[model samples]
Target: MTQPLLSERTLLEIAEHEGLVLKAYKDSVGVLTWGFGVTDVSGHKVGRYDTANGGSRSSIERAVEVFEWLLRTKYLPQVIAAFRGRALTEAQLTAALSFHWNTGAIGQADWVQSFLLGRRERAWSEFMNWSKPKEIISRRKAERALFFDGRWSGDGVVMIYDRVNPKEPRNPVWSTGREIDIKDEVRAALRKAGSAR
Candidate 1:
């Protein structure tokens, strides 16, 4: 039998998917204050903070809360299921997932999904070549360089609670982890995922 592709869920799990936890206690509103540990703005956090200082009906929740919510309510489960039956690496899936998650297309990024499903790596190249404002946070030049080269990467996108991202909100990411022959993992999780759905 052909090997299976690694499931996105498995990729996250292997990386110890604890969702987002706070690096330190934030303010009260969950809109991100101005302090944090090593993590940057896109960096995930688990504590509270002033999210918007008052805006729309969207409640000011913690960075971690939003991160987890996005992971769940945003259709991450479906994406993970797709990865289960494809020839993708954990890092590739994570990179794309985390990238879209940080951006606002958590469940609506069609190009990303289609590219991955179609196994078109070249088509995915330009994903990192977006405007800096589009990127969630930090080290713009460096981030662009690494993402395009397919080698080297940062700690990925982080959800900094109550803090702005350092380095000017560039793309935060590291080398797609070891490229694994994911066929096996994909096959295994596909049946299981579909059944649950």
Candidate 2:
């Protein structure tokens, strides 16, 4: 059987939560991140060296390009494997992918076990357990809503935050506060960059 692909709406959902940053910055935990919350690219952990000589900055198009690549090559596969061959609805897959992308705990997440056991209510409740750091509660709530309610919110508009000094502090995302519905731009960029799959 062919693997299912994430819907555009689903992609936008994840992107909105992750937000967009065209430059490398350290995340809440001080891990170097770039282009839609990516911490690593091709196994190279994003580092301060990446910021040297303005090497870390990228166009929005390029940022989308890299984000899509990570989703396709890394996060998607991990989510798929976590499912262990069980079929899932688009909403379920979307929620799972978003959850896994953010937390990287899909394989051991208690929510997955609840879901597999047909206790969807428990699954939704358990999903909230991953919410730590306090700031992540909103994302967990969104993912939970998507999983159980099939409600994917967000205007497809994502905030483009300003890059901060890597050593400055943790999770200090200084926003340019610029928001754009990047679906069209990302689609055009992907078309120009070649097939997304």
Top model number, lDDT: 2
lDDT of 1 by residue, 1-197 (tens): 24334343433332221222222323233333222121224444323332233222222233323333344444355455544555444445445444544443434554455565664564345454443553333333333333334433433233322232223231112232232233233333444443211
| Cα error, candidate 2, residue 68 (Å) | 0.8
Candidate 1 has a TM-score of: 0.37
How would you encode candidate 2's per-residue C-alpha lDDT over 85-117 as one tens digit per residue?
888888888889888888878999999999889
* Ten residues in sequence with the least summed lDDT for candidate 1: 170-179
Number of the top candidate by TM-score?
A: 2
Task: Give candidates' CA RMSD values in order.
Answer: 11.6, 2.7
Deviation in angstroms for 35 in model 2? 1.2
Give the CA lDDT, 0 to 100, for residue 57 in model 1. Answer: 21
